[model samples]
Target: MISIQRSQHSPIGLQLGPSSATLVQLAGSRQNRVVHAIAQEQFELDEKQSIEERDANIAAQIRQILSDHHFKGRHVISCLGSQELFIQNVRLPQLPVDEIAKVVAWEAEERLPYPLAEAELRHLPAGQVRQESNTKQEVILLACHTGILKRHLDLLEQAGLTAVAIDVEPSATLRCFHNSSNDVQTNATNCYLNFGDAATTVIFADQQNVLFLKYIMQGSNHLDHAVAENLDLPLKEAIRLRKIVTNSPTLDASDELHRSVIDSIRSILETISTEVENCLRYYKVTFRGKKLDQLIVTGNESSPWLIEFLSDRLSTECKMGNPFESLKCWPTSTSILERPGRWTTAMGLAMKEKSNS
Candidate 1:
């Protein structure tokens, strides 16, 4: 069964992506916290491999990564990929807390693309709204395919890890931002962007709730591919060049090849910028009169160039999100400040509080 309980002891937060896995461990409470460990690994699966063979390979890689990091816990909290879950916000007539679930489930049946019986559903009451004479409640609904959830659980079990809770990725990313931001209690709206290997997630939220969310099927991998094709370099070389560009802001424009690579990167950023603008426009239409206060970018793929470009393109203050901003790191812990974007989901998963249930 999928569980949502919290861990009193240190629990590992493991994020399994299409091409990588990230793990983070934290100890102590929110008031006084320390990062225990953080580690990431990339793995490959051959297209010709059988399903069982692929799973075994992934489990093996995870086991090795855990051992390498010396991660201390067996209990873990994990997140479902964006493609594996369906999330939506709905409004329902205000009712007793006990009656909300039934109505939300009924609404899910009508809105969700899949049959309700094949999905596991969860809902959180966001807030109340006044509609006509009656009050209405806004709820965020999340549903995951039962089969996909089971496969993830089984994979973890096979890797000798016990999953204590399963959360959606977008929510996990939002949690990281909310916990780390100094202005989290403010009423200003904030937008968060998390760029993954093959996808990017956009989340618009305020001090109290999530206002909008969307997933775009474009990310750093596209940039890597573009660079590879333009520079006639292997994928690994393209990735290395991309990192060099991100790390060195002052590129010597004298080199034709270097300029070409930069141009390709800019083109990809333009595509991402357009999508972000679209999301912002949608939010404006849905929540009239409220404007985004800032845009925060995170994820392994986030870079200096992308952040600056997006800031100018959107005409909104843009900054990098640090998942460890609020937490202290152990003296021996690896440098989390180096690539904070990659750990947002894992850190957020580690910050989960005990459920009332």
Candidate 2:
């Protein structure tokens, strides 16, 4: 959602995480787009650093990335990292568009873990739903704690960037495919799963418009944790084993170590799959509009093993998604985007049209 004056130009799309940043800029008309600039850098998060210090360091990193690339313009759009915001679809009596916000505030106070006064609340009217005999409005309610939201804007200002819009992960993730999904049948429902370092986002959409989304608390990092606990190894050591097994195409159940690693990873992935199943079930039961047509999965850790596991668990046509498929780019940009999953969120943010709503 937008919070400030909309930019007149195509601003940079910046995606920030706990330990890294990915920024993408695109130019040209909708029919002939090109990747203007793209880059990603990772940094170690030191627990000893205070929040202010941490943000400053991140801001410095953003500045460096900007200077080292061909990114133009200072206006940008951004998103809260994984688990940074709370999202839920709440039901209310049909109300005027201008009256939704006040009612949404009451709903937020009742549902949020934090107080109402401390939140930056926003709501979108997502059509009407049947509640027994009565029809109720379904509003997509979003709230990011004020402290976290302020910190996000602060970092943008520190890096000499103007924030035109600050979006959430699920919305940003869905927007990634907006430009390229026109040819698909709009009547059919589709799903988008975005895996990040700390969380995975599931978005259901039709013709690039989001129907609903779910933010799973688990991410790729959970794989490491599961392996460490299962194998009784140090966190770092477990990561070593996980890196090998997760991406390995050879999942020979006959091999001892491979079986052990796969089992360990499966324990956590199963839990994630269960969550996704529940999400899909909820969507079908609540919306009851259309059957799932496809599932597009993307992430930095979206390895063959992980994709295969998810596809087998989920009953749909699951495949990797490339957001830059329609964009022209040089080898330098292509090299960094070799694994397109990680760039989905950033590209989604950049793809957003300037809005006054």
Candidate 3:
């Protein structure tokens, strides 16, 4: 929970995700060039209902959260993951920005499996490319079913929150990273692994360009379940232990508990590494970019040694991301600053809303 005072007075931005909502109350002072951001309470939801059912439940949950905090400012921005949005990067004749909508529509109709009428689309120019035949250019068109976008918007409105902008999660994640790190501004290529409860999302970006986005079935909870089964412990206990133990710190000599947990996670990481490597190879040949500089692990329960283990196995630098950057961390209350990496998506959403406002 970092507090910031910026140079300009901007309306507060609220970010809502599937599982949680993170709010940042902001104010700015011009003379000081400071951005004042106060992190509000985080509200977690079940978020496991069927898509249709999830919306109503989430709406209620959000309303209650706002009531609890007595929050009224409604300018909000939400994010949809790559899974929810269909994105395609295509090369086209260098055209004016006004012509891009029609061109992108034509390309989407030709490229996407879904019908153009069924999809709600938007496009952004990536950059110009030099081809042997001509100087071609590319644009990344982001599309999603109108129904899907509507559902998210409806949910927020039902929650009594104003939804101002809908952004892609990959873009939000990358923006959050760039805002936090000066190193990434130098055009370094890196992979961001977002481990959720049931799934892991990997977004690879070169500087500002998003190269690959995917969702993996495996995640931290999968490792917890494996450990629970192997140790014959309750699910709750297994979860508690999972956050504490790593390859270096095995449980005990008599019990193979430590080995079991490490082995389970190692296997999962290996499978993910293979998939990542294949994606990297494709980008390397297609785009002719630098090799992957490192991998950043982020999630609620990211263990320190798990980062070490994966770094060793993948032969890449594995560092935990800091979700609490560009803000002032409260000294008296340490809970918000603790485990900040896991809040990357939520924090990114909050940051995006602030920027957009």
Per candidate, the number of residue pairs that clash is 0, 0, 12
After superposition, the stretches of candidate 1 with alpha carbons farther than 4 Å from their true spots are: 1-9, 89-97, 124-138, 179-187, 249-258, 289-291, 330-335
The superposed Cα distance between candidate 3 and the true structure at residue 273, in angstroms, equals 1.9
Q: Candidate 1 versus the native: TM-score?
A: 0.86
| Local accuracy of candidate 3 as per-residue lDDT tens digits, 1-357 | 998854343333444544445554334331222224434343333446576677777677767766665544666666765456777778889888788899889999988768899998887665555567577676777889887778778887887777767776566566667744334543678888776655677767776576656667676567778878877888678866766564233245355656666665667777867776676565565555457787887765455665766677667788877655544442234655555665566556556534341
> What TM-score does candidate 3 get on C-alpha atoms?
0.74
| Candidate 2 structure quality by residue, lDDT tens digits, 114-134 | 999999988766666677888
Model 2 misplaced stretches (Cα beyond 4 Å) = 1-9, 179-184, 228-261, 328-337
Q: Which scores higher on lDDT, 1 or 2?
A: 1
In candidate 3, stretches whose alpha carbon ends up further than 4 angstroms from where it belongs are 1-53, 69-72, 91-99, 128-138, 179-187, 197-199, 217-260, 263-266, 289-292, 328-332, 353-357
What TM-score quantifies how close candidate 2 is to the native fold? 0.85
In model 2, which residue pairs have backbone atoms overlapping below 3 Å? none
Worst 10 residues of 3 by lDDT: 26-35
lDDT of 1 by residue, 1-357 (tens): 899966444689888887679998887767777877788777876869987888889999999988998888688899888777788878887689999899989999999888999999988665654556666677888888898889999999989999988877777777775645455435678898998777788887775367776778787678888999988898878988887776554556896756878887777778888999998887775665666788889887666666777888998888888777766543354455655678888888887766611
